[model samples]
Target: MSITRRGFLGASLAAAMDGWQPAAAAGARVTLDQLQPGVYVARAHNAEVARANAGEVVPTLVHVTGAGVLVVDPGPQAAWGGALLGAIRALTPQPVRWVVNTHAHPENVLANAALARLRPRPVFLASAATAALMRQRCADCLARLQAQLGRAAMRGTTIVLPEPALQAGGWLHTGATAWQVQVHDNAHSASDTVLYAPQLRLLCAGGLAYQERVPEMQEASLQGWRQALRQLAALPADTVVATAPGTPAQTLVPTLAYLDALASGIGAALAAGCDASHAIDAVAAAPFRRWRHFHARHPLNVQRAWRQLEDLWMQGEPLA
Candidate 1:
């Protein structure tokens, strides 16, 4: 009951890996780094800067349990999932007992089937809100992933849901460890979930946060997301692990800064009577020009934030 996570995950590595055929086409390998004593993050390069590296690793967060592991955001595609499993095996012999999808993205949760096939089977966890988004967007999600990961790589990929899904701020206990789960709607995607281990001071902040990349808005609540970050910043936890495997939590400050800037820019543009397209274009300007996918992502963020601002303005919400 007093096992340190490093002891659990870094145990028995001499014979850790299962026999796995690495993806020759994807030409990528999932490598594990012990960020903390028991916490391992599987990451390749900055997929934000290089999407070709996106297939390299879907970037997952692993929590070491006594005889098992808890994974956050198991990557995209069956092949990537297989690679992720092998990476974990290299760290410990503990079976993956639970997987939490931060949101309804294929890159995060499509590997559920592969993990579900373990001997005792793993419990899949997600918010009911995220599950509903999966149901509504599964087909479209598959289509987009297939186009990105290629049809062959995605073979056997399916939508897997958490049974008895949590609503918000639910408790998940694994052996001697427990995680407080929080779910969000209109923050990142239609929904997002973050898991916090208070004892360990670690937070697996699903899609709610990003690093070294521009955050996208797929039915996002721009202002709501800002509020969510404010809440996360208030947490006593010092270390936060988001979907991006190797990035530091301190970078979250700039990411939050970017979102706030987008919101303020949209509000100012609207107040100045700039049209939606013009506002989006105007916001596509400076400071964020250096971010990955700035041109591609800025317009969408502006468009979404613009609408939310319009409604708030109509409701007499004060603008700064």
Candidate 2:
């Protein structure tokens, strides 16, 4: 099925409204200098990239509270995490009292050691599944990355699991606010959480939500992801933040559409073929062709979605 010109324009418009500003066209590069007084934004770009790789620039933010400071998602390694910690210090002297991991991603959880060095160690928080994934898989995750990226580059970075895991079905309190954090399992990752700050009206979602690009997934549950967004829409948050090209203030639209499009494409493929590879290739080649660069990654998002859909179909589960 061909995407009509009108459909393409609609997708393009949605992408624009939701933070898919073209890097070349917008000529907008979010830097630390442009941050506001109460906000601190840090992007960790990979040290290896010659032209500055986007992987290294995972922007983490710190919001200053009257009582103390609240941090959202620490970077994957010490270099990025340490840089983020330093940026927060420059913004304020107040000890960070609360640390929230938007989801269980290595890039977001590898900097707890440096953050703990503060006078008062901040309490770490994540969704129940995220906490389990962190505790069970964090160290091995870092080790694997070190093996792949080389230990020298991954120096001073260890996976430190957060205490007090967020349980399913409700909000969790951190600092002065009862943050409406939801536990969304098997969506973007094994377990992803979306944080909704009523006071700030900000939604800090990890990989479950991304900005200006396709949603990267290792293990994705399409139905769960769609439902999670529906749940998030009911929250009081007006602004959505994620690990992306810019700060949390700018909403992420591409990630949402990426998931929706993947689900749609996969459903069509399953009806046409019995093999998962065929489904994956067809989906990746069709509606997702424009996102070819993203397809280079191993076990690409479509493949992951295909696997998840296979499990669901095998169990006779209903599709979204």
Best by TM-score: 1
**Candidate 1 residue 293 C-alpha distance from true site, Å:** 0.9
| Candidate 1 clashing pairs, residues 3+ apart or interchain | 5-38, 6-37, 6-38, 186-221
Off by over 4 Å in 1: 1-28, 48-51, 54-57, 245-249, 277-285
lDDT of 1 by residue, 1-320 (tens): 12222112222332232332434455335667777877877764545423465454345888788868988888776556666776677666788888887788777777775676565678888888887777778779877877875777676677776664765877888767778988767787778788888887777887666666778776788877887887887777767777464333554576788888877777888788787777666563576777777778877777777888888987989644
Q: State in Å the error of residue 185, model 1.
A: 1.2
Model 1 residue 319 CA deviation in Å: 4.5
True-structure lDDT of candidate 1: 0.70
**lDDT of predicted model 2:** 0.59
lDDT of 1 at 297: 81
TM-score of 1: 0.85
Q: TM-scores across all candidates?
A: 0.85, 0.75
Per-structure clash totals for the candidates: 4, 7
